[model samples]
Target chain A: MSQFLDFIPKIPVADSVEDAMDLLTDTFAGFFDVIKKSGKFSMEFVTDFLVMIPPVLFILIIAAIAFFATKRKFGLAIFSIVGLLFIYNQGLWEELMNTITLVLFSSVIAVIIGIPLGILMSKSKVAETIIQPLLDFMQTMPGFVYLIPAVAFFGIGVVPGVFASIIFALPPVVRFTNLGIRQVPKELVEAADSYGSTGWQKLYKVELPIARPTIMAGVNQTVLLSLSMVVIASMIGAPGLGRNVLSALQQAKVGNGFVAGISLVILAIIVDRLTQSFNKKRQ
Target chain B: MEKIKIENVSKIFGRHINQALKLVEQNKSKTEILKQTGATIGVYNANFTVNEGEIFVIMGLSGSGKSTLVRLLNRLIEPTSGNIYIDGENISKMNKKQLINVRREKMSMVFQNFGLFPHRTVLANTEFGLEIRGISKEERRLKAEKALNNAGLLPYKDQLPGQLSGGMQQRVGLARALANDPDILLMDEAFSALDPLIRKDMQDELLDLQQKVRKTIIFITHDLNEALRIGDRIALMKDGEIIQIGTGEEILTNPANDYVRTFLEDVDRSKVLTVENAMIRPISLNIDIDGPKVALQRMREEEVSVLLAVNKLREFKGYITADDALEASKKGENSVINYVRTDMPIVPPEMYIQDVLGIISDSKTPLAVVQEEKLVGVLIRGVVIEALSSSDENEGVTENVSIS
Candidate 1:
């Protein structure tokens, strides 16, 4: 059995795949450049705007948002105020802003692309069969694999970081949207159709409204996943609190890493609570 | 006018449609076709015509294809073979645009489970059909409000469907369909979700609404009692085939097959059989032309102690007993009108037997069935009992005795 196993030769498919990727990169070089420039410009603009805000004012704005989003609940609002003040006191405020910008961009992009694709998947069997496996591959694969292609296309920076983060965070929104729309009762769909609704009318009037809560849940998941991608993205020179954590890890600085990690957790909790409140309000 | 005509329409659900349809043509059994070709026949060669402003009911137990047959009328479930015509236009042959236009302008449907959008308020739900038709916002809103008002649901207009009771939500469903003002209304077990009392109220309300709008309606239900109550004509289905189509009384008297007879076995006959079915030709005297002696002679000839008295125009006057006639004759009364008693219960010919049961049970004399102020027939107690009992031996006897 060992001799038989040894008799099998290794295939040269890896080299062929690398060669094919290179050809694709070369052919779409101009297209990729345009996307890279635009992506970098937008990311920098958002980061600069967030950083320029007076820290106290930014904290107050977030607290107020949490206050209203949670229907005047004091807990999340108080948490937002205290948490941001602690991050500011620890001198990690700028880094927090950078991570916020990165997460914001990645999540928005993922939703823009994912929802329509999800609708397509829900509507057509052929699209579903084709896209389902791709989504599974995207979600189940280790997060690091996306960085190689991201770096290849956009080079090492915040743009490539966002591109990788989007790939990491996109599946939940797509899957949830498809699920939510499909879960609409058959009777409701028939009722809509019986009323002479055109295809688009039926989807907009009946399906999307009923599926709103489930879709919002997916969106919440996507935002959190995007936030989680920040640390991995920092490896590709994306600036954020993730960089601090990354460097602290390299030097084994336990205190620094702990502080950065805690900052991320606070941010994650605030975002989760805010999204959940919005979802509830919609329902 | 014929609003809809369904011709040889069949719906077979499966991959081997051609083989299944061939088996269907060969008159093979539904289960045999399913076994041989892996196809389930939904509706098999259904044929019917619905007149404008009529409630045409299609009824059967679950999985009997009655629902499938109703869906075929609007082409919601496309027929595998044959044609459906609406006002002489072939619905099955129409392209997508024409079909959509027809659905939008010509027909609307109400569903079994209420099918109200949980996210939408009652007003919004009611407005859905009109909105889909591209009506202007103001016009649709007004129309929806009017429909809601008609259904007595206007007070709950701003409430979501989840907040309303099942009957209220179903009222919203009906209002939604009515808001569109379509030519035909397709209702698939629309009241099946309601409680019995609410179901009865809704049925009565629907009949009341029918009197005002007069839309051609194709209603689907499994409840035979409901079909009998509202159906102008009923089509009974079994195993995807329409077994019979007739008025409720005709089907009750002359069932098409054993399946129909069995299907109807549990029906409450008092609810469906009208007084006309139980009424007999009464032995009556014209009080204006006949004297008390003549009335007594006619009572003697008919071998009855009492006689119904009418005027020269055959207008029902009252009943006269032999004693009253004899006393009147001895007292030298010219006509039996003086002796006639006006205490007997009088009913209209169209009144259901159930409605007259109390009146008949309390009255000493046979009830008079009057139509247009004329004594058309008399509903005797024995005839009513025989009709209510639905005895096979006396079925023809009571039915044949009815005045056409």
Candidate 2:
């Protein structure tokens, strides 16, 4: 066997990877053309109904809920003011709601898939070795890059947009979940084993408890990534504050773009703070 | 009961091909498999049985395979070639499910670092083992409550392990082990990580707890004194083999070899020597109220030099000497008295010559009360030496002998 291995030629690894990339680029070009020819997809129904609820009222309710959960009155005040500005300045209260729904929906789906993948990675070295590189690529790859596949598969709509968003935002959740489970103290794992814990029992009771902080960190990252994806999702005809922001940018509506950007930042802060508060409560 | 045993157990690592190549390159024999693969000889032919309810101690320095030996008994790491029999059944080759059942039903382990679930509250951590056995939540909670109460950690039930002190966390670890009502407990240096004072307290607590439970315990530690304090039988290990296996008295008195002797050489015999074993048979002594002349007359007549000083009530006060009394008589003095008080520590009859010598050196006095704290006989070293050397037929009894 040693003699055989010594005689085997070293394979040309880099050439194969470059060829694969070329193939992907050509496929994406065709995908882009089809989406541009079709009418832009819209989730306007969700927006119109969501917009009917006064933007300030919705923001107040959300901020008030957050303030109670976190016990931070300052958070409520900031969220309320940010909500008022989006309503009065950008005049796209409905668009903000549409974006929030998209972010929340994709985040929920990402968490459902990503957490289990992360946990599996933690348990299995093989899984971690395979999935880790994929996670790195997913996180670094641009959200607009995801749109090419979304457009090809789902034909340019809010469903495609949300699907794309889920893919773009999933890496953090999965990576952190894996990290959290992996970070569980070795002694704790041994203790569980000594107690005769079956594989699943060890995972659920021992691994997960220690992993809560990392999982929450993943959730926070996922939510932020989802929010950032909103603007890219707009180019695929997903209607939201992201779409309004893009339109305002294209028409040189600086004032409107600024307000939309501020609302997105506020949304990111709210999600980040809420998850952190939940983590603190758990600890 | 024969709790566990290992024979010719070797766990080798590295790729099989690599190991083979290394062995061939080194021109080593099959017996040298461990060295070729860089695999540790964790429990090399470790063969010993922990009797039922015995506080069996496995003592060794770190990396001496004491921990590995304990882990092997429970099949935590499968022996490369050996069988362990627990209560007459071969457990070494038990399937995963069987091993799990055995661990759940019969044995529990306490780790040195406590290994408490930092995320779980003290109650939950205590209840973990019971939960793994498929016990109902309510039943587990009740059992956990009882275990915690026993370990004296009930007041901190809701606190997470991170919030507890090291001692309290270890108590939770113990509680978790006890909650399963295991027949045998494996402690791998369980108290070694605590502060010295806390470690002592925990050791006392363990002894007290063991008195009630009477579960067979296999404790691993490097501390010889601790092994002497708690162990009913001890296996002192070096490398991967048991150097000696004996009762505390056996190891303390007749250490198996130079290695075992060196380990016990620094041990304080008073701490280890029991008062019962150290009691001496009192020798008759003649004394007087008026001092020197009468004491000298009795010593000369008896042909023994020294006499124990006593009061009218016949309670021992100290020792007086014939030589001193004779010198005083010549000087026309009423008394010449220099003595070790009776209240001072008596060299137990069971004490080694080394310890007796140490006591003599420290006291800076001619005589010592030899009855340990009992009202046994006073001993003089010269007389004991004379008795030992004169009786050549009892040489084995004296040389390398244990005063049991």
Predicted model with the maximum lDDT: 1
lDDT of 2 by residue, B1-404 (tens): 56655554544334564564455345454447655565555656667777787789999888778888888878776666656888777778788898889889889999999998877789998888899999999999999999999887899999989898899888988989999999999999999999966886788799889889989899999987678777888899887768899987677667789988877765544444333333334433434355577777777777767666655555556666566677778888765444323444455443444356566556544444444233456555455444444323433232323332
Q: Write the per-residue lDDT of candidate 1 for residues A88-185, one digit (tens) a residue.
A: 98999989999999999999999999999999999999999999999999999999988988888888989999999999999999999999999999
Per-residue lDDT value at B173 in model 1 = 90
- Off by more than 4 A, model 1: B270-404
Residue B362 in model 1: shift from native, Å? Answer: 16
Docking class of 2: medium
Question: What is candidate 2's TM-score for chain A?
Answer: 0.80
Cα lDDT, model 1, residue B109: 94
Off by over 4 Å in 2: A1-49, A81-89, B17-31, B265-404
Model 1's TM-score against the true structure: 0.84
Candidate 2 positional error at B327, Å? 30
lDDT of 1 at B377: 96
Clashing pairs in 1: none
